[model samples]
Target: MPAFDAAAEFDRQVRTLNALGYPALSGRTEEQFAELVAPLRAEAVAHAGTPDEADAPYDPAATGRVPFVLVVTRALAPIERTMPLTALHGGKLPGFVDRTFEPGSLERFVATEEAEPPGRDGVHLLFDVERGEEFCGVVPNDAMAAVAERGRSLLTIEEGVALMTHAPRILVKNKCFSLGGSRSGDRRVPAIWISRKAPKLGWCWAGNPHTWLGMASAGARRV
Candidate 1:
């Protein structure tokens, strides 16, 4: 998988924005862009969770509009502040754009949802063929043994037989997408699952900042 690089992405966005005849941002230097995107990237990392509960479907109520605004505003601040008024007021640029120093001004620009539902809580578990008592959670030992036995039995069965079997197959489905679909179009939801003894399963929703930023920068490209 490719690594995430917010600064490089921001730099690319700035170049694209500059080319579109948008007002030249004052301090939109590569270093400045790096500074701005670093926090967002860090936020992304810190927020990482199981695939079932990644950053997807951002809760407007939980995160609010402020953080989103801050990200955009900070990313654009140097550009707005350093760019000359002539660059902004001239036909070269549109009028709706203006520089402001007020904290959280960016937050006001982005919209957020009115409400969100709470996440479900559950414990992580791993069972082996031996059905040792080392497992956790409220499930009794015999019940767990039965579950393991059933799982082994299913795995042993032929695919056709498994399909025909009415017994409930253990299915672990992450609901991150369902939650994310409820939010805005551009947000992302990244999640992961850390099994007790196995490698983690990772997943994400639409919260690709690069794609989202690219789209927004494209809008700015329109002179």
Candidate 2:
């Protein structure tokens, strides 16, 4: 498994944004880019709180648009291909080979419901199985909902009496995209969030979602 390199990933993000003409972000050096995005990253860290206090009782209402830091490491071997599919309900999750299309954006990588097309910009990468865990970070229910609507899932099951299963993971590479802040009632909410910008600009379900009730994630302290 590969280690998550935040600095390298940050450089990649700056390059992508530069290539895409992201307003004033173009033509900046990697160091310069790092300097520019450092505050945002710091803000993410601050929003997530101390490592020990994050991802418990996932609560987005309170976080309100603060950004969080996340380390994007390689997936575990057994279920490496099985990405954790986020949904309002597990029933909403797509089965093996099932694909769904969602809006595309430059903020992060986008996946197509259909299998790899001839010239589509998006890629069909799998999600990390360890997503939504405390070690990764907290992902609020609303964030999960936001991901489910746009993200696609794929699962493989063996044809047998007991039905053995194969990997099931979400894509985390290729196209670019971003998560819109969660909403409460009529007002839009912005909470701290994190994404892997290198291998791809995407979010993982590694954070423990159950802990988001009144906190960011399971085990996270309520601020």
Candidate 3:
């Protein structure tokens, strides 16, 4: 079985983002993104032999994906800001906001009261990310509470987008996830899933439950 390649993943992420013109969309230059990840790249190289424990908790032998995700935070790349620029399946299909998500600016979807992302500008490496697959069919409200009790914070809209941005395959036909990190001062919870075989930025009612959607979470975020 193939193991997760942290270094290669990091490099791939960088090149993919640069190819997508990520830096410019986030008020950064390609050179700056490279500079930001230089140390991270080095660290990845040094630790290439062993991927982070969190990256593979959910059947590493089967998935071969990593625990953490490389993110350009809402501070640098708001959910709405990154929506048009985001894509699915390794940048093959561009993402878009659902017409029903008339919430104007996706930034309005703020982190929930119990959640705390590394609220700073620039890049973040989010570790131990759970796609909330277990939370499928769980209502958004209950799922958020369960996440808190487990000492994990739900993924914010920005983080959700970032996760899919880096690992597009994670957002599949029936295994989509909710951004428990955000709420629009209403019963709506922001989520990402496939729409007509394409990744979509959309919302769901907090009170409802879906057999296919799970609440996503992360153990930690940092520079």
Candidate 4:
């Protein structure tokens, strides 16, 4: 298909946010954006706690080898894909796992593989880091397929959980973009009408928020 135009998308998001009562975000420099969202960031910090105090211990075996296994499960759909500012402007929106998606019982896992090919079946993408590299396993093939979708998927396998959790919290508290979408059956598909500029920071439903949010509040926070 056509390239995803990042510049146009960003401008459109800014306009949408303006209409929604948020300060304009389109033209602001990263620093300016930071300032505008400072309060929200602080709120996220309070909720998340300190980096050292809030995190789980490190594990060495998670990343020592390649092609790690993970007990994958469906967490959330349409998580922000990590694309560089240039790539976005050039029109290449990718995919990333929704940080919020952890089995209510198990919140940790790892991956040794780089991520499955885009159309491959299975939960091949990685998220939640520990030490330099780590991997884990999950069951249910659809979990993998849900995480890997039509866009460029940016799932990090080796890092720290802080990065995984903090990144989204920062964006949410900063009022980056809220999750707005629809619920089909048990699955929540994001609303496409809402414009999301920072596709890497948080999950913004793919379309109109009103239809989704108005019809069912269930999908409001799933992302």
lDDT, residue 49, candidate 4 = 22
Model 4 over residues 131-216: C-alpha lDDT tens digits? 11110122212322333342212232211111222122122111222121112223333211112443342222223232112110
The sequence of per-residue lDDT tens digits that candidate 1 reaches over residues 75-180 is 3333223222112111243212122223533233222222111111110111111111122222222322343344321111011111111111111122111111
Q: Residue 7 deviation, candidate 2, in Å? A: 2.0
Estimate TM-scores for all models: 0.21, 0.24, 0.84, 0.23
Candidate 2 lDDT tens digits, 1-223:
2333334433444354344333232244656544544544433334434444343332322222111222111111111121221111123432221122123211122212321211221111121221222212234445445444545221111000001111111112211112222122222121112122111112323233323211121111111
Residue-pair clashes per candidate? 21, 54, 2, 30
lDDT score, candidate 1, position 53: 38
List model 3 lDDT by residue over 125-187, tens digit each. Answer: 777677877889988889988988999888887787777777776776667888878877888
Ranking the candidates on TM-score from highest down gives 3, 2, 4, 1
Q: What's the CA RMSD of model 1 in angstroms? A: 22.4
Pick the winner on lDDT between candidates 1 and 3.
3
Q: Any runs in candidate 2 off by more than 4 Å, and if so which?
A: 25-35, 38-181, 184-223
- Alpha-carbon lDDT, every model: 0.23, 0.25, 0.73, 0.24
Which sections of candidate 3 miss by over 4 Å?
39-65, 103-105
Q: After TM-score superposition, what is the CA distance of residue 185 in candidate 2 from its true location, in Å?
A: 1.7
Two-way lDDT contest, 1 vs 4, winner: 4
Each model's Cα RMSD: 22.4, 16.8, 3.3, 18.4
The 10-residue segment with the lowest total lDDT in model 4: 214-223
